[model samples]
Target: MRAIDLETQVLAAVERIRKGEKTENDLIECKRAWPSNNKARQLAGSLNRAAGDAVIYVIGIDEKDGSIHDTSDTDILDWWSQIVGQFDQVPAEMVRHIDVPISNESVVGIAFSSDRAPYVVKTGSPKPSLEIPIREGTGTRTARRDEVLRMLAPAIRVPAATVLESNFSAVHYPPLASAENAANDYRREESVHAFGTADFFVEHDGRDLVTLPTHAMDGIIEVGDLSFTLNVTPDWFQSETKAPRKEYIDRQREAVLISGPGVVPLRVDVEGLLLSHRKLLETTNSVTVRLHLGILHTSKPLVIEMELNTNPREHQLPEDLNRWSVRGK
Candidate 1:
């Protein structure tokens, strides 16, 4: 949704919660106020219950009378710290808070995306606090082994997509290095950026949530600590099949940055790129180039894979940069 439509959509959601018409389903929840430290213990479990749902928690609404508060003065990070239980486990964007008006009073509204759910949510306080929780009707309860499996289903995938599709989600490209500005040596600062949208789905899913066919990336949720690895393969023709070449793309890239709180658009650059591009051309002409990207995440990385093919694509031949340009979806 565009920025203009987001708040309006949020207000509608808040209205649903206030009217007593919303259910405690996979996507929505309600809370009376920012919780006390003791009540904060339930926040982690609440996150787990959401799984890969576009979970919303409406706060400062009186449960008995569905009343809104006069104002919401609480810091969003305070509630975030309770739900995430750690630093860098979840990006700030995944969690959103708004002060929405309902009649004469206002309510604090919080939204969470399940893309990063089912990971270990800890407060770093003490023992017995590490237990994962799942939603049981309107309340949260400790998850059983089987329940844990259901939540963990979307995070772990068995295979990678060899040909990129409309729903695959991660899109990346090297920036413009036009003919008039062509250079033999790739500067250290030059980089390629991958922008992921709602279309790019997270892989792991347990029991499917309530997703419409029109919905993009319906069940794919964000996991934590993301970085990517790339592999490039050139089209092999008359030369020799036995000596076809392969290169790990990141080795040529200097750094990897993923977007998060305080990080809007992340950027990474190609390292020793001049040398890598030179080697690619020696292998084959640009009939087609196969790109294999690995979306790896977490402190201990778990990879979500994507494969793509670019046709009629630019091949920066070592002999000339006069004809170099790139375009891909």
Candidate 2:
């Protein structure tokens, strides 16, 4: 599920609980405060095995009375580390940290899913042992032999990812496409630089955990009549790199590896203009841009579409073009 979707679900659950109404989903659990590291590990581990779909552990409200509890001071990253530190080989990207704003404060939620079941957590005294804890209807228990075998058996695998977050800014220079400036303007001119930032994460399979490598991703941008390709170059992509183990990160972060930021450079040219350069002055004030991305492992392609102003206000331009002139020497 997308982060926003998780936030919505948690907010709704919180409201329902506050009104003394029982939520229909047993996969959701509420906590008054951040559980101890040990407890946090247990809850995460159990939920990893228990959930057949998206499950979440929300913190900040009293589970019993549904009263709002304060947990704003906790660092979300630290809390995430606490959960990741518990297991040696927990399902990859098994948990995502979610922040929900409520009553002028932010609450923490942990989203978990695992198909690579038997996500065993390390527990016990001097002789630590791996235990596969499964949550069964609000209760957790050790997985039975048959259950363990079922989890271990080969299951259908579908590599996937979701756009966790994305933001972009673009401008279309209508004047540059005018027939009057055909001689002054080059065939192509850089219109928008630093197009945007995007975070993509491998979509979790409830029955099995999945990882989509960042190295296998490529993208393209289409604006008006122009199309350009984009690339995701993680540090590990370099041959001389010594970065830690690299995972195929699809814009996913934290428990999921977040690929390096990709800056989309857009060049608008007279020839690429959708309308004839002869009629460019009559073009509308805005143009639609689309970004299409594909991952080597996933069949689904990520597409983002946005509109940019062809002739922005004076303040939006880097320089006052009205005061400038393209005069022949």
Candidate 3:
């Protein structure tokens, strides 16, 4: 999962607990204090297998009363290590952690993606044994023979998407490089001082998340069917300058393919979006843009929406110059 998504999921889990919406089940678990090593292994294994997409294991919330508690006694790394060290067949590194603030105190929320299901936990004791635990509603138990086989065969496979960069900003300055006569009354177009880019990636392997089987990824989620749109606040801005739109269709410019176990990036450059839009500076000092990207990662059509803004005031020229112009010697 992306960092933004992880933070959102963890916070939502904490909120559900506080609201007393429901007891812990297949997707969420809570604890008032840190758990023992044995308990950590069981929770990790059960939740990892049960969560179809993702799960949040939260700390510092009373499972019984749903009251917030301080998790400052130990940091997140220590908590992660306790659970990770107990997994024998599961990929321990797939687990991610976040800190959730409540009132004046804070709680630790652990996020796990279930792309790699059927996790096996190693029990500790004289009669140590490896077991595949799964969560069924509010309780957990060892997976039956058929359940393990079902998890082994992925029912759905979709590559995960994440934002690499989402930024838009501009500077408005009086013409500085022009040498034309200032006395002319006709309106002159201003050079584009705004710059921005929206970039994101899609990964085929577990390097970015829990990996889907190579065959599964190949059979599902064709990269060629992907389409995207860049919506500008002033629609005229995009219509007037169609270079960016054309570049998107030109396959030679941006190459995205699911060739092997790797990732491909889709980038949009909007530095010159206001390049030729007449009165762009006079009409508005800022511009807003939104990207609606389409991809088939979960065997369902998924659209990722990201918005960016540009502030021309932040890029204005210094006060020493009222209007920059070339002085004819």
| Per-model TM values vs. the true structure | 0.40, 0.43, 0.45
Mind giving the per-residue lDDT tens digits that candidate 1 earns over 1-329?
23333456557766666677764554555567776544443555665665444556667765556766643476767756554444235432344666676677776666665566564545456775565666676666778998777676664222212222321112223444675444544533333222221112222222222111111111121112222332221111233457755421111122222221111111212222233343342332222122223333211122233322223233343333212112225
Stretches off by above 4 angstroms in model 3 are 125-128, 155-329
**lDDT comparing candidate 3 with the true structure:** 0.51
Q: Give one digit per residue, the lDDT tens place, for model 3 in 169-217.
A: 3344445445464446233544444334444455445322232222221
**What is the alpha-carbon lDDT of model 1 when measured against the actual structure?**
0.41
Candidate 2, residues 1-329, lDDT tens digits: the string is 68887898889888888788986343677888876767644564454554334567788887567777788778766876776676657643545777788877767777777555667776755565777776666566777887676566554344344444443333344446566677776745434232444444444434433433444444554443645455543322233557775443322321223233322222222223232322332233444434444423333334444444433333245522211111111
List RMSD in Å for every model shown.
18.4, 14.7, 14.6
Best by lDDT: 2
| Every candidate's lDDT | 0.41, 0.52, 0.51
> What lDDT score is found at residue 209 in candidate 1?
23
Tell me the TM-score of model 1.
0.40
Model 1 stretches with alpha carbons more than 4 Å out: 1-10, 13-23, 86-93, 123-129, 155-329
Quantify how close model 3 is to the true structure by its C-alpha RMSD in Å.
14.6
The better-scoring model by TM-score among 1 and 3 is 3
Candidate 2 weakest ten by summed lDDT: 320-329
In TM-score terms, candidate 2 sits at 0.43
